[model samples]
Every structure is written in structure tokens, then in C-alpha cells.
Target: MAVNRDKKEPVIEVQDICKTYFMPGGMSQSVLKHVSFDVMPGEFVAIMGHSGSGKSTLMNILGCLDRPTSGVYKLAGKSVSDKTDAELAEIRGREIGFVFQNFNLLMKRTIADNVSLPLIYQGVSEAERHERAVQMLHKVQLNGYEDRLPTQISGGMQQRVAIARALINNPKIIFADEPTGNLDSKTSDEIMDLFTALNKQGITIVLVTHEDDVADYAERMIKIGDGRKVYDGLRAEYQKDEE
Candidate 1:
């Protein structure tokens, strides 16, 4: 699907970012090298790469989970490269939603409690938390499962709960890292369809996937190799190049 992105300010802007880790004996391993990209509002973008391609490093930086060794990252026009760890956490809570391959729900907590965890950090009242948790559960079609434990649900349903948790804050952008990795094909397709529907509703989605079928769901494709972006273009153009 070709999405028509309007000419608006980018939701994410990464400029000349690099990440490196030092090893024993004064050795250093560079994970990312001068990587740069921008994700516009309401765009669905996939970052694809094989293992050791540094795509994970890039994703970590983009999701605010880790800071780059050098360069600038601007989330919603605010530079985040120099922010303290505490400041970055604040920014993450306010601006980003994250979904992971392993649904990171608290096993002991009820679905409602898990979904409302973010709001707790934001100091939302208990009444508001309950109300918003129910609302988000409805959004993800898990309305009746609120009181159930996460282990009681199927894998797909657990992922849905994770999605509801991610949506509780109404974030400006969503970062999904191999979101369907553990699901069967049919369930994967359903989850991707849900992501498509969300994108259609004007949510900016940045998905990281190694599977071509998974990446196909995105309107834009970005391939990273050896710590650098090898391709950044429309999905159609990427298909042509692959052919």
C-alpha cells in the first residue's frame, strides 16, 4: 500500500548517529556508523536487516532504549542525544509506545493492571487508570479479558494485551520490534492487519522485522547492513529492486 504522506514536520529525525562499544585490551566494536533517517507523521516504516546488521542497535537508539555514542536524535523536533538517562525516560514515557517480540506483560498482574502500568508512572488517578485501561482494552478488542492473568491467554491474545498497554499513553509514535515473531502465520497476518488499521488511523509505526512478509505490511522500507542504511524507499520500489 502506497501511503501519501503530507508535507509536515517529521516525527523522528536522526542525524549522523553512531554507536560503538569498547572491548577488553582497548578494542572497540562499532555497531552503527553515521546512520541517519527521518520518519514522518502517519507513516508506516519497516526497518529490515539480517542478524549482525546493526538494525537492532538502530532500533534501540530510535526507541530511546539506548543512547548513541555520537550524533543527534530529535524526537518531535526536540534533540534527545544530550538528555540525561532520567530525561530520556521521561521523553519515552511521553512520546513513544513500544511492542516487542516477547510480550512483556507482568505475569502476576491482571490484564487491566498491566495495561495501566504506564499511567501509574504518569501519576494518573486510579479511577482514570481503570477507565483508560478499559478504553484501551476495547481498542485492541480485548475488552472482556481485563481481569484475566496474562498466562491464561493465548499468545496472540497476550500480544493484543501488549498492544493495549502500548496504546494506553496515546503515544505519538509506536516502535514494534519483531512483534509477530512468536505467532503462527495466520495470527501474524491478523496482527499485521491490526497494525495496518492503526496506521490508517494516522499512527506513525516503525516496525523492525527480518521477515519479508512482515516488512511487506509497511508502506516504506529501510534496509540496514553492517551498521549503515543500504536502502530507504517506498515498498514498491524495494520490491522492484528485490526482483
Candidate 2:
């Protein structure tokens, strides 16, 4: 489905966001400084930065895992920055899907069980959870491996399981942090292809990575440096600027 860019408002909006940590000595460290951006529905954006560049802090805020110390964040037009922890958890469960670099799967659980976890929290029936898990596994092209453990699969396959788990909740947005970090180059390409296909299906995706090749898959790129946004524009423009 082609995204109706003209009619849809931004799915994510961050305004003058900042995150700070205060030490016992009355000293403070700022991680993100006045970071602001907007992500439209069905857009695929990459957040690129080196270590200590505040990309992780921005990701945490975007994912609802952590609230910004100061700023306004609107997800699907609902203000979330000031929400209580319980409310944030609910929002995360309902609207956001997260894919981590580590593939954070339970080693003892079957792939099907892993994917069904999110639904379990939402109190989905056992039969329905299994059914939805199976469907998502199929979507990730892992049709018959639902019964296997994460350790029984290859690194790439485990990542696919993670992606399947992320999608099982039918979230409006997906936040992937270095999703291809653990895979070989060929497998990374395959995973990126899967993400691309999902984006084409109208899912908004925000991926965080330091690799230019990985970021190239995104339609837009936002680069950060020293705890602030350094660039935000079309991928073509970012590439031209790099050149």
C-alpha cells in the first residue's frame, strides 16, 4: 500500500527533547540535547551515530522505554512524555514493537512461545495466541520452525524469530536497534530485505545503526553527533552531503 503522505500526520514527533543524568555530587551529564524530528506513517528512517552520540538515548525515548527528562513526544498524536510509567508501558505494549541487537529471546522457550509472549500480556486466549504466532512465523518465512528453540536456529534465523515476535503484536511502529549487528553480510541483506518489504506494507520503521550500508536501506536518515541531531533529510541528500 502506498502511504498517503499528504493526508496522514506524523506518527512520531519529538520536540526539543533532552535527557540528563544527575550524579550524587550535584554534577549532571546530558545525553540528548534539544533533539527534534518527525516520522510519518509508513516511513522508514535510520538513526545513525557513533558511540556516545546519544542515538541510544533517543531510541529509548522513542521506544517509550525511557521518558525524556525535558521535551514533548507525540506518538500517533498522543502526548507520551509526561505519562506515568504504567501508562508508558501500556503504550509500548500497544503501539510499539522493539527489535534488539541481541535477539532477546528466551532460550528455553519454543519460537512459537516466544512470539506469543506479547499477546499473553494482553490476555489473549491460548488458542488465539498460538494461531497468531503461527501466522507471524509464516510472515517471517519461518513456517515450520515454531517448535524449535532459539539455540536450535542459526543467528540469522534467531533474528527472524525476533522480528516475528515484534510483529506478533500488530504494532503501529517498529524500533530496531542494530538489528543486523549479529548477522553475516548475506544474512544482514536478507533481514534488511524483510524490513523493506514490511515498510512497503505500510509499517513505520525506525532503525538505529552505525553502518552506512544498513542506513542506506532507509528512505530517510537522521544522523546525530555529540548528543544532538546533526542531519535529517532524504537518504539521497545525506549521501550527497557525505560525498
Candidate 3:
């Protein structure tokens, strides 16, 4: 259909993406069926859906962790399907920052060390990595907490450190999969506020959350059901309709 094509070159472009997994007896299960979407530059968007709606599968494909069975995926206007694993890793390392609900920090490392992981992978010098990580911690308002272990900090602070780690790479876009899934109510608000602040500074963010209130924080919301995009629009318009 005409909806599959757009005049503008989206920062992320996916068309007719279908993903299937092989089952025990050679049967295949389709996780994403003809999923297609576009993400523009500097956009703050949230994806919401139920457990079996294929949102996670779409996220994996969008993040380049998995490939689609029959479709095209473009990142930064370049075709992802043609890239090798090393090339994909290079693209992800240099352009995408990821935040997860678990905070995924290394308990054995200090906060500074935890934040420096990506830079280390990029072959940055130790001194430069620590310096950049420290600056990022300061940006997230965790300046002096660098020496502390994640266990020593509050849940909110741990998430803040994770946010800092995600930003340390100065990525083109940040992908947050259920960023506040494990946080308490108050902590969730704080995380949302952090995202707001980051967005104000021009960081593109793609968030996935099932909670409507959480999704409202994003500029745009997309709802998926039965492997199809059921709703896509500005959050304010969606809220107005609900009222």
C-alpha cells in the first residue's frame, strides 16, 4: 500500500518486515507479520502493547539484534539487511544506546566502570573512558556516586546511572525497553522526568511500555495488537479522544 512508502527518509525505516521462528516439528511461528513503521529524527516515541502482540519482536528487529524473514530495514537511511554482523555491531556501538528495565550493571565494577563499558568496546583509552563516564555521571546528577557499587545506591539512582551509561556513547538514538518496568511509582516518575530532560536536549528516544501514563510522557505513542499497529498518533490527541 501507499502507507508503506514515505517521502521523507526516516531515521528508521522498516517495510513489510516479517519474522518467523521454526518450531519443533518444522512448523514455523510468525512473530511479526508484515510489520512496518518509520521513526523520524529527534522523535520521542513510545510503543505499547500486550505480551503477545509482537512488540518485543519488533523491538529486537529494530535494534538489529535479529533479522526479519522478508523485508527491508534501514537505520540512518542505510540498509541494515546488507550489513554483516561486524558492520551491524559497529553501527549499534556508534549510533544506538540501550536502556533496559533491569539496570544491567556489573556488580563487580564501580559505577564509573559500568558506564564505561561501551567506550571500552569501542577501543577508547582507559583514561578517556573514565573521564567521559565521569562526565556522563555528572550529567545524570550522580557526580560523586561513581565510586559506589549499584547495590549501594537507591533503585532510582541505579536507573539514573544506567541512563548515564546509555548516554555516555553520545548515540544518535536511545532505545529503552520497559525502562521503568522494575521501578516503583515515584521512581518511575523520576525516570520519566530524566527522559524529558534528555529529550529537551535533542536526544532521540524510543521507549516501550505497556502503561498508558508512562506512554503519555512520550511525544508520540504507537499501540500494537495481534502483530499489527492498531494506533499511532500524537499522545495529546490520543488523550483528548480518551477524554
Q: What TM-score, computed on C-alpha atoms, does each candidate reach?
A: 0.94, 0.95, 0.92
Answer with 1 or 3, whichever has the higher TM-score: 1
Give RMSD to native, each candidate.
Answer: 3.9, 2.9, 4.5
- Candidate 2 scores a C-alpha RMSD against the true structure in Å of 2.9
lDDT of 3 at 40: 89
Candidate 1: tens digits of C-alpha lDDT, residues 97-210: 999999999999999999999999888998999899999999888888889999999999999889989888888889999999999989999889988988998889999999
For candidate 2, what is the lDDT?
0.92
Worst 10 residues of 3 by lDDT: 234-243
Better model by TM-score, 1 or 2?
2
Residues 25-138, model 3: lDDT tens digits: 999888787878899888899998888888878888788888888899999999999899999888888888888889999988999999998888878999999899899999
- Pairs of colliding residues, candidate 2: none
Runs of candidate 3 exceeding 4 Å displacement: 1-8, 239-243
Evaluate model 3: give its TM-score: 0.92
**What do the candidate models score in CA lDDT, each in turn?**
0.90, 0.92, 0.87
Which parts of model 1 have CA positions greater than 4 angstroms off?
A: 1-7, 239-243
